[model samples]
Target: MNPLFRFICACLFTLMVLAVAAPGQAQGDGWPVSIGSPAPDFRLPTLAGQSKSLSQYRGKIVLVNFWASWCPYCRDEMPSMDRLLKSFPKGDLVILAVNVEKRIPEKYRKAPVSFDFLSDASGQVQQRYGANRLPDTFIIDRKGVIRERVTGGIEWDAARVVSYLKSL
Candidate 1:
């Protein structure tokens, strides 16, 4: 084997190892709150102008989603989230859709959202939750410990997701 070829192969192998390990090791960088971490609490005004806080939802499984109207994935997964919210009884689960956009879009205003639609106009709440990406979701257990952190869009009403939430 050629010396340069062997060196290239070794570099490629090392890169592959890093890529595989990145998700677990990069948790602090990409996901500020890891599984089992205590979720940060914050209070923000909902679309109805009511002040809401994470602590207020204690004893209930909460799904805190950070989103923006301009994000296509955020908009796409909203209906599924609403459906997911409906599947569970009112007191069984709480879904807080925190909009990070400064201005509320006309479509969102007109949309029939069953969950609590909170407005993070200044992005303070989103920042506290370390939601740097749009459509980030944190599933907090009844005790207020974050059980899961999902970044990006997903089918909120999917059977698997529903089962997991139910188990929590």
Candidate 2:
């Protein structure tokens, strides 16, 4: 066999092996929640000792953020989310910050925000949403359909982002 042909065959074999090993490599973050899917309904206890469900906000745009208090990015993006909350009229939008951990961090004890911070003690809600990574966000329309799935941190109050939400 020609040496060049052997090298080409080896490379092809390696490529084939990689493709089979990681079938989901093409997906940016392997988020199971595909865009346009119905947002999974979940009831989680709020920081205020109340329970909230995604279905309750069916007539409003909902931003379901999966985050942990210790995650710096989650903390950083939260303020912008507050600003985003203020942009629209009352009841137009609902921001649900679902904390994956069991305990609410002390830092949030006094932090003022318009959004609701809920606790996912059992992590069942996180698993249901496939939020394995911190700072994952799902933008659900008024009809409860997930319009977007964001994998990482972003300026939630950016003009373009707000405009996009407004359009929805």
Candidate maximizing lDDT? 2
Model 1 TM-score, all chains together = 0.78
Per-prediction backbone clash count: 0, 0
Off by over 4 Å in 1: 1-31
Cα misplacement distance, residue 113 of candidate 2 (Å) = 1.1
lDDT of 1 by residue, 59-136 (tens): 999999998888999989989998998999888899988999897776676678888788899987787677998899
**How many residue pairs clash in model 1?**
0
TM-score winner among the candidates?
A: 2
lDDT of 2 at 57: 97
> Can you give the TM-score per candidate against the true fold?
0.78, 0.80
Error of 1 at 165 (Å): 0.3
